[model samples]
Target: MRRAAFGLFGLLGIVGLLPQAHAAGPSDYSILIISRERLEVATSCEIGVYINDQLAGRLFQEQSTSFNLPPGELDVRLRYLPGQVPGCQPGIENQRSTRLQLAAGQINKYRIAVDQNGLTLIRAGLGY
Candidate 1:
């Protein structure tokens, strides 16, 4: 009887730990931004993600390819090297800003345009 009780307690302990062990994985939300026009990808251009005006992360031109963010509301700013002319400057020179509300376990896509002033347009919707 003692051995059986010990084994039952061990099984319950393992079952309790299973949920915590399985909690680690990719973020619950994702976003993708693609350029609308074909331009030389700038090496210095960066995409900044802000949560409640706080700096969350920055993505370079290549890094802007995709994003995995927590489920919440975020203010996203895509800023290029300010004061530089497009195609003439050494880095990107544009800016685009938008807000997003992400739901848990949802993937969304936003088609963005980067011009002289920054992200000029954002087409956002659910993703497959």
Candidate 2:
């Protein structure tokens, strides 16, 4: 009878721990994109945001976009959409790409801009 009682208690204890054992921490990774370059506005073009070589967003000047991404190495690129505006061409000078190793529940922000030299992606903040 004592062995049976002890086994019951042990089984209950294990059952109580099942939730904790299976529970996972937050695994969401996010990226915030900001298009604040005067160049895009001046040229009246929408910027194409790419993730892993896929077009993710077409951001306008001063606009922002947020994405929930998988935690891993991501290739981020920004380019001008060719037909979005007049005088806006698909020039290599107006694009940028970067690889980021993101962790679970982490958020990163970036800004796209165009300078005299070329396009650039600048890290803007850590969250939101």
Candidate 3:
């Protein structure tokens, strides 16, 4: 019957649209930024955190911030900006960026350290 054929076509159209929608949008994920542990570094100064050269968060000593991001590649950096707040400001030292690939349903964590020169970022382990 024509009604049965039209219903099947409509179901096929809906099923086809699901894949296209899923492919176009990536799943949401999270990235956690932790301050690296060091006794010699100044704890009072809030270090600047950047993603893709943009100021994304501030890190205090032994503190952390988590950001929800889409699945993709991101440029992460840490800086020791002396007089900047929620802005990208950095000197020659301690200003570096590296690319990170993120997948869905994963929680990526990184650490930042500040010393005499400036800031240092490193991939961290989740201690059990």
The C-alpha RMSD of each candidate to the native structure, in angstroms, is 6.9, 6.1, 6.4
Clashes (backbone N, CA, C under 3 Å), per candidate, total: 5, 0, 0
Instruction: Residues 52-80, candidate 2: write the lDDT tens digits.
Output: 88998887776778888777898887777
TM-score of 2: 0.64
Return the top candidate by lDDT: 2
> Which residue ranges in model 3 land beyond 4 Å of their true spot?
1-26, 37-40, 83-91, 114-118
Could you give candidate 1's per-residue lDDT for residues 1-128 as a string of tens digits? 99999999999999887866456666566554544233444444454554456656554444345566778877766544333434433254433357778787766665545555655446655443
Scored by TM-score, the top model is 2
User: Which segments of model 2 are wrong by more than 4 Å?
Assistant: 1-27, 37-42, 92-96, 126-128
lDDT (tens digit, per residue) of candidate 3 on 1-128 = 99999999999999887855335555567655455555435545567778888899876666778888877898887766565444435445645577888887777776775445556666778664
lDDT of each: 0.56, 0.71, 0.68
User: What TM-score does candidate 1 get on C-alpha atoms?
Assistant: 0.44
lDDT of 1 at 86: 44
10 residues in a row with least lDDT, candidate 1:
81-90
After TM-score superposition, the amount by which residue 71's alpha carbon in candidate 2 deviates from its true location, in angstroms, is 0.7
TM-scores for every predicted model: 0.44, 0.64, 0.59
Q: Rank the candidates by lDDT, best first.
A: 2, 3, 1
